[model samples]
Target: MNLEILTPERKLYNGEVYGVQLPGVDGLFEVLEKHAPMVSALKAGKLKVLKDKSMSDTTSYAIQGGFVEVFHNKVTVLVEGAVPAEAGR
Candidate 1:
């Protein structure tokens, strides 16, 4: 699936990803390739980017409360603000 993370100031990420773990308002949820379409509110927490199923490379962001939309094999995260998570590797 393709993923993009955006804030008012700039785009944080734009690329293909295997899946993504998001901080939904109620809890955590994940979006994978060809996942069903939906929209959800988000909370301030860590967002994990799964670059591939092999799990060799990944990214994480510290995101403030935001919203997420999943549709057509794409996941878009709109955040109040965000920064690269210190724990990313």
Candidate 2:
């Protein structure tokens, strides 16, 4: 799956991935390749993305509330606010 994380300022991430774990408004959900089309509201929490190979670990990001759209084998996440996980250090 191709994933993108965007904000009003700029595009945070855009690339291929195995899966993603999103903090949905209601709860958390995982999106894998070939996932059914849908839209979701995000919560203020962590966004975990599994990139690279099958056994690869996920990368975590911190973000505020936002919306997510899935289509055409791609997932786009738009956030009210976001910062790289490392930035929290």
Candidate 3:
């Protein structure tokens, strides 16, 4: 699936991912390729994405709060703040 992480400052990630875990406002949910379409409100927590081609390696971001949209085989995350891999998991 296509995934993009966006922050108030900039777009953090834009690529294909095999899986994604979101910190939903109500709870956490996972998304995979061709999964059901949906939109979710987020909580202050982490967003983890395992690159589409690999499962062991992962990328995590500390997000203040955000929303995730899943559609057309793509996922877009809009957040107030986000921390990328270089910043630590």
The TM-score leader among the candidates is 1
Error of 1 at 40 (Å): 0.3
Score each candidate by Cα lDDT. Answer: 0.93, 0.89, 0.87
TM-score list, all predictions: 0.95, 0.89, 0.89
lDDT of 1 by residue, 1-89 (tens): 89999999999999999999999989999899999999999999999999989877888999999999999999999999999998633
Query: In candidate 2, residue 78 scores what lDDT?
Result: 99
- Clash count, candidate 2: 0
lDDT of 2 by residue, 5-54 (tens): 99999998999999888999899999988999999999999998889557
> How far does residue 34 in candidate 3 sit from its true spot (Å)?
0.4
Higher-ranked by lDDT: 1 or 3:
1
Candidate 1, poorest ten consecutive residues by summed lDDT: 80-89
Instruction: List model 3 lDDT by residue over 8-62, tens digit each.
Output: 8888999988989999998888988898889889999878998855667788988
Q: How does candidate 2 fare on TM-score?
A: 0.89
Candidate 3 residue pairs in backbone clash: 18-52
